[model samples]
Target: MTPRIHGGGDHLGVARWDFSSNANGCGPCPLVLRAVQEADPSHYPDPSYAALRSALAGLHGVEPARVLLAASASECIQRLTAWRWRAGDRRFWTPTYAYGDYAHAAAAWGLVRVKEPGLAQLAWLCDPGSPLGQGESPDAVRTLLNQTPRTVVLDRAYTPLRLKGDSALSAEQTDRVWQLWSPNKALGLTGVRAAYALAPLGAQPDVQTLESLAASWPIGAHGEAMLRAWTQPEVQGWVAASRATLTQWTQALSDMLVGRGWAWAPSEAAHGCAKPPHALDATALRARGIKLRDAASFGLPGWWRLSAQRPEALTALDTALNGLALEVAR
Candidate 1:
């Protein structure tokens, strides 16, 4: 099995100035935080998650029956792949560069990777995509919808945290595909493992299969609370307001990097990739209590993906880079 490659706090512990994760730099929204903190762990969550599904469904203006819960986005990816495979999907498609889990899950099921979208039985799309933060083209999505893929899942993990531009797919187009949402990132509560998907219109049969395949009580009380809080108006408002601050921080971070001569791939989200003029020494940066996500795992070697961080974190990054430069000069 290929080891999963991900960013954020790792075995050594959290980075003091972590730029590895794409969680909302300004949050752990207070309201959501309170909900999670206050969650009672004395008992199990409702096995069926009825109220939670209704709330999530209402948030997206979909039927509650269209909701499918998962322990996390990655879990959903694995389960969905397994579901499709059991149903006889032998080929899958993913963007040229995308979340590792998509390919990982497919490989686990012995599904062949197909380059062309139409050749796939299962496909994954991430709008405001990771590593690049580029939005998918609506026309392309429309075209794909008209194709033969039995299951097309749009990972909306970054959509809530998008800093600029709108989602390319409109509501109607969105209704034609599965919309997988992981709010933990948007709420700055990545530690919380909770995610749900809105099944395509009239996908009840598919939903039933997915549900049957799910482990009972997939979400515990804390995850349940965090997700429930996500449907609240104030929590949404908090997330919306944080974007302004993140936008400012993003500009400052971009200016700092550009000034240092790094090649930037501008993103519409708080996080994006850039190639440092020289190959970075991950250990050296970690020694300085700072961390950056190397893009090699995402197939963009020599480039690093960084999220918009606070002024303090940016200054720390600058100092760390200077130290590296001095070492190179020596």
Candidate 2:
């Protein structure tokens, strides 16, 4: 049976205090916003995306040939899985609780989910991982890399939003596996779908094959503008500055949850998980313009994952929690 793909931002209409999605709370960086707004709508972006790819490659200190752009991280996951399936890979493995799309894509492509990393033809590793926001061990990464006849992709979507701790992989270690990045989250532009991947140093042939499977002009003008702005020094500086604010917010939110009898889950990133003392009336919270992600979809039942948001949002959440507590008391 195929697993369901669940995400934080659903079509339930926008919430006034949306702590469900992990997008940077401090951004839509001003510089990036302006760039995207100014993008020409009359003409198509250069079909090759040469300049944009080169900029991203330069930022990561990789060759332009190693860059693979996608419409979004989800799209990239599906495309990569399809490519692997076509290449006769039928076994997949994920090191920890991950975004739902990885498992969904594998199931859609008829790939068997494997328990052992070494036995799978394809593997996924996310540093400062989703839902729980914990980094992987370097030893585990080395073990996966040493596994023969395997293709490993490291999802780096949250790397930019990490508030504390560091990645387990060194530059040398990371170069041995595919690195997938989605700048939209860091820039607070999740509405704009754009992502890119850096292939392993000698995986040019594999990268070329994946590119061949993609549709013509995979990214539109606005996405092109967003990706282009992501490589700028000023935009990166803004993101770095925003982390300080997120750190403070995360600490405040954790303290609030603990005070209200919720069990705070340890995390190093800007987002974390917490288990409520009792089952929550999610529908009630939604009506109050508040949203928290149910972590059950990420494999942790009875827990919710929340992104660090502004003080106003936190206050709203506190009020909602109080109301729920009163309801339970009555």
Candidate 2 ranges beyond 4 A from true positions: 1-4
Q: What global local distance difference test value does model 1 have? A: 0.91
In order of appearance, the predictions have TM-scores of 0.98, 0.97
Would you list the C-alpha lDDT of every candidate in the order shown? Answer: 0.91, 0.90
- Could you give candidate 1's per-residue lDDT for residues 1-330 as a string of tens digits? 445889899999999999999999998788999999999999988898999999998888888999999999999999999999999999988887798999999999999999788788898899999988889866567667885557889999999879899888888888888999999999999999999999999998899999999889999999999999999988889999999999999989899999999998979999999998887899999999999998888889999999999999999999999999999999
How many pairs of residues collide in model 2?
A: 0
Poorly placed runs, candidate 1 (over 4 Å):
147-149
Worst 10 residues of 1 by lDDT: 140-149
Per-residue lDDT for 1-330 in model 2, tens only? 546645446777778899999999887789999999999979988989999989999999989999999989989999999999999999999866888889989999999998878788999999989989999867777778784868899999999998888898888889988999999999999999889999999999888998998988989999999999999999999999999999999999999999989999899999999998889999999888899888888878999999999999999999998887898899
